[model samples]
Target: MSEILLYDIPRKDPENGPWSPNTLKARLALNLKGLPFKTVWVEYPDIPSECKKIGAPPTSTEADGTPRYTLPVIYDPSTKKAIADSYAIAEYLDATYPTDRQIIPAGTEGLHAAFNKAFMDSVYFPCMFTIGPLSVSALNPPSERYFRTIRGDLLALVDSVRPEERWRKVQAAFEVVNGWYEKADNGKVLLMGDTPAWADIVVAALLVCARNLLGRESPEWKAVSEWHGGRWAKLVAALEGKVLYPGYGWTKQGGQS
Candidate 1:
């Protein structure tokens, strides 16, 4: 089969490659399935245009009623299909490459969906205040400008919180998620026992982004790495060393083929 094309956003740190949690989900899924793919980096400001050019549908609408396109889009040369959204891309990959280990295993769709919703609400949302500001610094100049412009209100909200309170909330959010992981049978590293799946992809993606955003040696990263007896850190290490595809890399410029 021909290589799959993954659309992702670029960060200023070329050494770290892609950094968005959403896009990383797609990257992790592709690697876990052992698929051959290459990244087509999309700049923050050029996402809509690049997506439109590739026939990827808009994932949402901006607050101003303008259609909003997002990355984590995949264009499959074999199938001549362009899929938008990370979850949808996962589903497509599973269906097309059934021989590979399934991301959303049979009889677990509802469970996975529910887990994703709760994760977004309980963990991702709360931790945004702590991690979101760090993302701004990681972007290239145009992307940084675009991020600051579109996320002014969110940035304001982030700034409104005191550092101590932000840390407390971030800790509380992860603690709730850590409790969920603890419920997994046999103290497994993955959400699903003895196997890597969609849930693990969702989590490891975030952990990696956090490490990049916080800087691996920063105090915030150190605190997160030690959380829940180092469960989160171990999870990322496992994914990086064992599961995810090692071939992932990015072009210097975004929105280029």
Candidate 2:
């Protein structure tokens, strides 16, 4: 039995904590395929150096020049390979484990890629603002600061906003996401084909992040979880036990390979 090691940022709760959506992508892909793996938590300051030691690319430029790596890096002992980045990891899994379940169903790969890109452009960033700040609170001081500095350079920090304005933006973003859900089977079914795929996983990650960052009762939570007439909530419920592959799922202490 070959095992894989997943490099991810340590957080308060693996199931509902401040986690990387990109990292969640790889974890979802692996779990979807029922692969066995273990997670190694890396501190914020260590990501770059740790990733480079495995021949991974720099995820971000560092002030101290420490290599600046990112999450979702996986090393598979069976194949003697270390893959970095979430999408790459998903693709690698698809190719290497042909007999196993796929990342995006067969034949729809091209279409799915295009669809995912469009969704990323339109919905991902907006959702980021809604959950990014919440994630920071779950991190240790150093990691939180590191995350804020890097992300803050790109957009306004969610914590800086007044409560009224914050909720308003979160509501607006939720509307946008709900609109997409409307486009996706009118919020009736999954985003892709009959079965769940990467796109669904993307939303699932968003939903999970929102839940983790915002208490379930938070207004932001209501906006996302209840928008589109409870589309997100329903979708999450439908996918709860399905997407997670066999054995040692996220519900467990360790869902590693």
Candidate 3:
């Protein structure tokens, strides 16, 4: 058995804000694999120390020897390996525990790889493009209050993007995913088939961002909304405290504060 340690922070909502997809993906993989791990929660803007302790460097660091940030970093004490980046971490877990439910699917590595690439390109890119600018714009006297304001601005941006536009892009992306699911025939599960796979976790985590942070009233998310409303409820239920932050609530279930 490998000893695993996870690092993350609460969501902006304080109730049910979404966890970083990387964190969620790693946690879900661990759960699916029936692995036990220790978790540590850290405050934002101070994640570099934690990253450094785990042997991963922060993307940026302050001049005073304080580290800026990096997230969803995992440390495996048994192997002395630390990993950052959601896709890399997920793939590592999939390969590391090959017998533990096989989230990535066998004989279709290329397909899964492509799905991941497209997912990052479609979902994460747009999200960052929209949220990043808003976050920067909300800067104030530089306090926690300012950070909260920035978070609010990002949320508002998500809300301001009309459901129609959101849906069109999301639906197109999902259609590609749906086709993959159909071909894989993994089962009736979302993303890759009847059973949840790595692709499902990736997509689900993205949807968590959209619904929990962005708002859930988009026509673009109809299929996803329905799935989350129905079969995928278990995933949400399981993630109650682990994936959703304390105050932020999930939009689909009327759980956000």
lDDT of each: 0.83, 0.71, 0.58
Q: Which numbered prediction scores highest in lDDT against the true structure? A: 1
- Model 2, span 222-247: residue lDDT tens: 76676777888877776666764344
Ranking by TM-score: 1, 2, 3
What TM-score does candidate 3 get on C-alpha atoms? 0.64
Q: How close to the true structure is residue 194 of candidate 3, measured as C-alpha lDDT? A: 47
Q: What is the lDDT, from 0 to 100, of the residue 233 in candidate 2?
A: 84
Q: After superposing candidate 1, which stretches have Cα over 4 Å from the reference?
A: 250-257
Worst lDDT 10-window in candidate 1: 248-257
Pitting candidate 2 against candidate 3, the one with the higher lDDT is 2
RMSD of every prediction: 2.5, 3.3, 6.9
Which candidate order results from sorting by lDDT in descending order?
A: 1, 2, 3
Per-residue lDDT of 1-257 in model 3, one digit per residue for the tens?
66587675545453434535566676666665555566666665556667877687565555676655566777877778888766667677777767735767787678778877887887666655443333333222342454555356655666787756755665566566555555544345455434566777776676665554544565433445665225434444434433333322233334222
lDDT of candidate 1 over 147-232, digit per residue (tens):
89988999999899997898898788888888989998989888888768999899898888888787788988898888999999
Clashing pairs in 2: 36-257, 37-256, 37-257, 38-257, 48-68, 48-69
Clashes of each: 0, 6, 16
